[model samples]
Target: MNEINNILYITGAGVSEESGIPTFRGKDGFWKIGSKNYTPQEMATRRMYKENPEQFLSWYYKRFAAYRNHGPNKVHHWLANKNLITQNIDGLDGKAGNQNYIAIHGRLDQMTLFHTQGDNVATQQAPWDSVDETSLTESLLEVFKISLSTRKPMKSQSFKPYVLLFDEYYTELYRISEAQQRMIDADKIIFMGTSFSVNITQMALEIAVTQNKPIEVVDPYPVRIPYENTTYHRMKASEYIERAD
Candidate 1:
């Protein structure tokens, strides 16, 4: 461990699984909405939010509220000492006091008022801290002055979840360049709880493969996509961390 510096941990929803926050692609997946059959990609789009702000906000806020009660697990705490690039929006890493990490996918605990210019864009809040559904609905109605039937914004003034929606590009992400550079610079790349299905994981893995660096993956199952020079540990993320000695 002493020889390791510039550590890059490419993390996914599995890291937070021990904390009782479900993985995004698990059986009860992010897109596993009820009978509506709307996928997470559909629900988390800007268009969905615009078409029916109330319904969109309700879905997002409810999920955010569920995440609020869960604190980070041991794996998150262990990762605090490393340079992390996480695909999770649950904000567990931040809650674990891992300030050195980059949340490439955005975070649920934070939000910003969109359409604000310059310095005003920085005004952010933990939606669960002060946002109430009733007040949010009232505010959307007041700000947009849209008819109930149409549900379209007359004038656009809205709060944006500090996350990358399905339609959003990595350019819209915060610190994406920094995250990429860290991935490139790291001599050691460790992956935890990722299924290799998302773009971020693909990017990280590609860099590792190109660099010919050794890869350590901690997951109970085999990695979804195999890579050369990778050592796999068959255990949950927290278990792997605890047994790292």
Candidate 2:
């Protein structure tokens, strides 16, 4: 039997595609909101969030709603025991009871205070959860109005979804140093459901290639595998995991 002790599994949006959640980058990903000129990328930035909190909240809330009902699939369950690193923010891995994983991108279920000073604080859940979405929106708007009326900027701001924006640095919250070390230490590396489009994926791939580690790539679509010791499986994440087991 092949020893899977030093295995490292790096996953992306493709892992959760089998579930109801949609990928947020490709053709199947979040495009533009209705009648909005800005793309999802533009909306999901610190600048946009600061300039127009209402619009930012609207888009973010929609994203949270979309991924709320979906649970982890076979891939997540199988990889729960493996050393996994995920770029997804849906939190399905956590829901599946997979603790041996790192979420490079922050999860949606968490909230953070929009502190004016340095370092925004993160909370397990939203500060005010008793109110429904509509009521929440209205309350935020009222707070904004109050701030404007009293000319007190402090009253306007509250919490924002704890997700990594496009412009944000991964090292801010993610265990990037630890993740990179894991990539370098892995004897066998597996790439699943990723397109090799993100920076972190590229970094991991380069590490594996430079060290001549054996690699297995699982994706239904054609993905670029630059390493010589790589075996590509043109299958979905769940199918590949099941077959390998």
Candidate 3:
């Protein structure tokens, strides 16, 4: 039996940040006092968008801008081949050449939505990440109300960032279904960089921890998962792969 046929992997922002992407929270990663500290849940929820379209759009656009020109780093490229799963929106894990992974948080490399009115809007960027500067222009940029007098920013695909924002249920349920099956089917799960923020992480951790799957977590500053006999390596994703390679 292929020991890893049932192998499941999950990742979080810590892994993506290694590739030069900016995360909502940094290791030393928070805006200082007096600055707006929008909780990830608050800023990333569907309710925020419904109540404040302008703010949501503006914040998302700026947030999306951080990923331009970045490519998957060594860790992402390596783990992509491990029958992986990730919560990152950066799309780097798959682009890094991991063939069997899914982006649980949704992908920034594509944009989409299923409107209540039955409108399904979507745009795909192939051979590159949807976060690529060109993808934004070709797909999503026009929704912004900008003037032609000054050069306008390229549009992201017309749909949202393809991410699962708060108040959004469809993608969340879909991702959870797949992940649950993966967890149930797998004998081992290697979790890297996820902060247990969403239901996905929480659920997977609950299952894996309960099942006593051999799990490993890798990070420069690894958290202490309060479980007996789980291994944690304190190192950057790149460093881990370099040694493993």
Candidate 4:
């Protein structure tokens, strides 16, 4: 019998591309297609949320909420039973039934108290559960406790999307410590569909390099990492999973 290695799968937007979601850096990726008035970097920040709550929430709702009904794809199902830390916030991993996977970037389908990072606050299902697409904007404003007239977040009643913004650092809210420990403990680390643009990927790569763990990258056009033990598989995530099966 082949010994099962404790492999850790770290995924990114590419994993969900097959599920009809765009990658953050792809030609049609979310970050690449920011709002008309602002760049994604500007729109997806804590500053935007605080200063221009309406525009921030409107942009978020239009881009992210549209994919709320998308189901998990083959890659998500394949990684469902494996140890995984995903940077995608689509919640497809959870939809695929991966009960314990860590969403290092946070989830779009959830919400938390509108507090700063490191605050130990509980999360709940996003208000989208109760509102349809047409009413999402008003519902969002209501749930986040933003005053409809003043367009400012109300204290204590405000909730934010459970996503990590560009201006924010990793904290307990996103399970950063747990993800680091998993990177250390895994015998092998598999990076799927990520462009190596995010800090989480860099953090995992550093851990893998320091521990001398084997690294495998799966992407149609994989980025070249300056690591000795890293292997690159130039294939789409679904194709890679099919070959593995």
**What order do you get sorting by lDDT, best first?**
4, 1, 2, 3
Per-residue lDDT for 1-245 in model 4, tens only? 55648999999999999899988987888988888799999999989998888789889988897799999998899999999999999999999999999999899899887886787898898877665557766776876778889887754578888899999999998999999999999999999999999999999999999989899999989999999899999999899888899
- Worst ten-residue run, lDDT, model 3? 27-36
Q: How do the residues 1-245 of candidate 2 rate in per-residue lDDT, one tens digit apiece?
A: 67767989999988998887777556667643421666887888877667776666666766554566589998888888888899888888988888868888777667566543236454466433443566655554343332434432242255656677787776635677889999998988898988787888889988988898888888888486756788899999878867787
- Which parts of model 3 have CA positions greater than 4 angstroms off? 1-5, 27-40, 114-158, 170-174
Q: What TM-score do all the candidates reach, one by one?
A: 0.85, 0.85, 0.75, 0.95
After superposition, the stretches of candidate 4 with alpha carbons farther than 4 Å from their true spots are 1-4, 129-139
Q: In the order shown, what is each candidate's alpha-carbon RMSD?
A: 3.5, 3.4, 5.9, 1.8
Best by TM-score: 4
Question: Candidate 1's residue-wise lDDT over 27-114, tens digit each?
Answer: 8866565225466677787777667766666577665556777888888888887788998988888888888789888787776655
Output the number of the lDDT-best candidate.
4
Kindly report which residue pairs in candidate 4 clash with one another: none
Q: Rate the local accuracy (lDDT) of all candidates.
A: 0.73, 0.73, 0.62, 0.89
Model 1: pairs clashing at backbone N, Cα or C within 3 Å = none
Candidate 2 C-alpha error for residue 242, in Å: 1.8
For model 2, the local distance difference test gives 0.73
